[model samples]
Target: MANGTGEPAEYEIYAIRYGTNETRLRGRNFILDARPDDPLTMDFFCWFLRCGDRVIVVDTGMNPVKAKKHGHTMLLDPVATLRDFGVEPERVETVLITHMHYDHTGHLDAFPNARFHMQAEEMAYVTGPWMGRRWFRHAYEVDEICRMVQLLHEGRVDLHGRDRAIADGVSVHWVGGHCAGQEIVRVRTARGWVVLASDALHYYEEYERGIPFAVAFNVSDMIAAHDRIRELADSDDHVVPAHDPRVAAIYPSAGVGFEGRVHRVDLPPRLP
Candidate 1:
């Protein structure tokens, strides 16, 4: 599967639904919930992009163990889920961390050889004073955040301050608001362009209405990021919302509940 760059030449995207739950904040005030399940438990999963000879995981879903302690549920087993997709954890050489949020970076330890890609500002936010205080406390896990910081100190993480291309057709853009240095990963799939919105815009509504996520460091920056995502996508359909349920339907669904089978990212029919 190795290509010219010694990475997987062909690209495939898989959508793994690791968890799902209803969020009152995301719907009633966040966006349009015209579907039967108004304020539906949108798809909460990670994305996998296989390019050339490399396998890249966009974000890791929530920690099921920590989730249960908090009275929440998870849909996939982080370890088994990727294995089912034929992706060996140790084989994942590149892991692009979208942000420092609990859901996005929980399973960092899973990718043994992964060279994590993240924004410098994101690292700054997670390690700064605002992390433990009220305004920015609830969204992150203290220990995990600290662990990521340690990883950075140990040189296991590759922090990117601005948008940079990790590989050909795969680039990381600094899109904030969801978190200080939150970013979106874009890959040139065989079909066309695919941008993993990793919380830059939680759902399509944010982009549609120009509203930022409730848990944001800077509302104005979030709004600007939304515009940036739209512009990068070129077309509305070209962009993919991180937590949107539509993503589950639009990308090929893989893996059993918790078995890690969601890496088939081929485009699916749009929801009408």
Candidate 2:
């Protein structure tokens, strides 16, 4: 879609790999038993969305402290990775946080000029009584949640309900399986609509193989999210899962010096 002046309402999306853990067994990733003995690469990433002169970031990546604690090796600091893309954190005006998980909510203070958009249910879920249970609060970092609270009081956080249009061709939808307020981003691109399936489907096989991720809050919601992801993308390849290393192999690199680290998700995937 384009305005009368003829500028297309399409955004360029990038999945920037910042951290990765290759020690996990496939059984640990899937809920049921699917190739229980196979090894898997679980990459950590924060997405970048740009349309014309407008820029929007998705997920902030993990704090270094959390990265070490989880045994996830840090390839590059996420903020620095954005700088590599020529996007200064200070100038970023909009950040769409996929959820309040430790991996997605770090360095809220990094983008001082940006308003963090999150699902209201997520903000509430992190602060609510259910957090008292260890099972419900395992992946959250207390410091990050506290920082979010501080930002909330400072009026720098924008919380949405179920679905919200971010820009001309960008939107976010709450899936609520991996976490109470888990969300996925959908952006219109030159190839077509693309869905950023943040934690809803960590690997393509999780969706394609009809198996949900293991760390789910609700299995039913997780299964239903697969349908939502399919509905939002133009094709199967258009849906980009949050933690798959196959992403880099499927799409071309973002640019020079970023090969294997960052890849453009807005472009059509390469054929096998």
Candidate 3:
């Protein structure tokens, strides 16, 4: 189990890979200089939170072709990735999109029973502010945003622009930096605290050196978001960086090299 809580049962956290690539775009300003050894590796993954038979997805890794256009080195098929993880896309009930980035919110329609959770500010930014600016351009698919808007209209989408608990041991906190409504998923495990810093701190270097992602909308807020990730983790060790390839290296690979690589919170330290 991912969380080491001594309960008879534990939450299963699966790192489903959607793609991988080297990205120079993530290196910007002084962030790369601050962490000179930081690699340009990008691991596109959608996290699965399994508590009992219930399945919740943290983010949906995108469709291949579209993902490639967005600077992803190699795009893995989301459907294929889900199947490899023993999850059926149609059975996913809840999908929490950490933000509205094209790579993170790509394959929503694949999950038939899923009701999405997103921040209200994200919707407004994508709909009103981002659409007008060149810098914010291609952040997402307008049609996909429209689909989310429709889901909101149909009452199938939950908008939480504020911090709130979504379920037992699981909560969503608004941490704006990369995007207006960007949030992180925090969960309490038997081990202690486990915080998924989905793009909030894309890699360990972002926090270790106080460097932020280059694609941020607000730099100070992004720095605060990085600090907030530590606070939510309740410790430096409990926070998980979403795209760091180091994760697969540190954690036990459940299957092949990248496949079944689960970051277990209850496990021993895999980082320096």
After TM-score superposition, what is the CA distance of residue 1 in candidate 2 from its true location, in Å?
11
lDDT of 2 by residue, 140-220 (tens): 998899998898899999998899988778889999999899999999998899999989989998888777788988888
lDDT of 3 by residue, 1-272 (tens): 32345553445566665577765444442454645555577676668777767667888887666766766754456667667777898888888999888888777788767888988888888888567887875577877888888888877788875797777778899898888888988877666778888888778878888877777788899999877887888688778777777766676555554543444443434666
Q: Score each candidate by Cα lDDT.
A: 0.73, 0.88, 0.74
What lDDT is reached at residue 98 by model 1?
87
- Rank by TM-score, descending? 2, 3, 1
Q: TM-scores across all candidates?
A: 0.86, 0.96, 0.87
The TM-score of candidate 1 is 0.86
What is the lDDT, from 0 to 100, of the residue 81 in candidate 1?
71
Q: Candidate 1: how large is its RMSD?
A: 3.6
Worst 10 residues of 2 by lDDT: 1-10
lDDT of 2 at 51: 78
State the lDDT at 253 in candidate 1. Answer: 49
